[model samples]
Target: LLSLIDQIPEDQRPPIKLPPYDRFGWFFGRNESETYDGTFQVGTGADHVQNTGVMRLWNGANRTDYYRDTCGTIRGTTGEVWPPFGRLRGTPPNVTVFAPDVCSSVTLQYLDEVERYGIAGLRWIGNDRMFDNGVHYEETACQCTAPEDECPVLDNGAMDVSECKFGAPATISFPHFYLANDSYHADITGMQPDPNEHRFEMELEPYTGVPLSVKAQLQVNLHMRNYGLTLLQGIPPVMLPVLWFRQTAALTDELADDIKIILILPDIGVYVAYGIGAIGIVGLVLAIYFSVTRWKLVGPEELPPKRAQPVMP
Candidate 1:
């Protein structure tokens, strides 16, 4: 029977979709609540505080891309911040291609997670406008260039200028909480055969302050569950777990402070059980107390008052 199964063509085999493991993507965002100054009387208050940004999972494709910028706004003596005017305040362009061909069915699950966070739009770029004492001020325009290894085409025929332009915008509605300056990652496995397998993983991290730096890292771990299965069958059952780590660092203290890290977990059953158990214990104790009090109030006198007097005599 096993031999017959082996004889069948690979296409005839049933498609097996496994649940994504610890494959995780992280995003960081600054919480803005900390920067508020209560005192109404103030000269151009200190620079507006930007909280650490938020994060999200990017599971659309095997390739990860990053784009970022630092924006600033000045405060007036009356405690008002101005927005970037014209082209000066506009966010830079960050674009990439996303399609089913670049990832496996299982890897697409990250898209579902992203939808939960309300980050559907493909706009990943950010710009800050700064005001110096109510005056529109401009910061040095940061240089933008792709890494040598990332832009292999640069080494080839006259660098493809088209590649520099932003691609068609792709929108993804993630189902998780995500904020600005978050990181995204995707990993695809089971692309190769036998001991030599092909897998692809990528990362994208965004930063929002001056001297911004984005770091994206991907790590893959392959473990053989049953070696014997490989000898008997052409394919071996294995477990592949991928992890993505992304971080954005900036020189500005406020921008660095705006960096937020969020860790989420799927199973909250333990917390639910604990809450239920606590409520049940409290209910049980109250019931016991009420029952004892009622029992104590019901005395023998309720049965017969005359009989009790005769017993005392």
Candidate 2:
């Protein structure tokens, strides 16, 4: 019905006589209760550090058919968990995660060091490289098949997820288009991209890899285009912002204290063991020194004279 209506001239097109529910409810889903289930494989225990919480299979599959080439391949961890970063070794340049929503591995660059709840952590934020759409980063060329004059290439920092979202003209970006190109901002109003509010960040305790705080913000947009259709003639080709969301979490003080004890007490235990060993060694050395000194202090002539007189008798 929509395709047929789209073909009609805008002036002659039939009005939407049906009610709202009948017209658009199917887009949401079936009203009846149904179990939407999937299988997820996560790395655990000793394997977690090496595996870094790998999403081995999602819905019983290890890959996605969202893109044409390797871009569709499901690589990296599930983004919720990461390998324990060595504080002594310092922070890396970036971190990668296979975000199911984006249907690809996204990399967040190391922004800076941050502290929360009295615990220090490394903060990583989504940069222009994340959704570059091949403008600045050649590695992301496979993410989009549209020509250089496409909607996303014109506006960097937003990736077209239409293929992943079942052919819907959808795109994803940071909240308020934080790192997006100026062209996207020119089409909209009241969009203020502040790093404090709009930046998507993950702050993790470097030593234990615990998430001290996380603010994962993402905006979903409708890629509006006329497509030379009669009913959609006046629509401009733009990434229209539909809705934006921010998912946030922070470590509580109680949890922070528990983590401190869990991470710090072992080093204290080693120091205590070393102190006890040192005390025992010192005591043994003093005892041996005193015994030798006492034996030497007793004159040799006094002990030898007494022994010789007894033998002669």
lDDT on C-alpha atoms for all candidate structures: 0.26, 0.74
Q: For each candidate, what TM-score against the reference?
A: 0.19, 0.79
Please give the lDDT score at residue 187 for candidate 2.
82
Summing lDDT over every window of 10 consecutive residues in candidate 2, give the lowest-scoring window: 18-27
Which tens-of-lDDT digit does each residue in 174-254 have in candidate 1? 111021012121132322221111112111222222222222222222322333344435544322333323333323445
Superposition error at 195 for model 2 (Å):
1.5
Q: Count the backbone clashes (under 3 Å) in each candidate.
A: 33, 0
Q: Assess candidate 1 and give its TM-score to the true structure.
A: 0.19
Q: Give the Cα-based TM-score of candidate 2 against the true structure.
A: 0.79
List model 2 lDDT by residue over 52-75, tens digit each: 676677666777776555566666
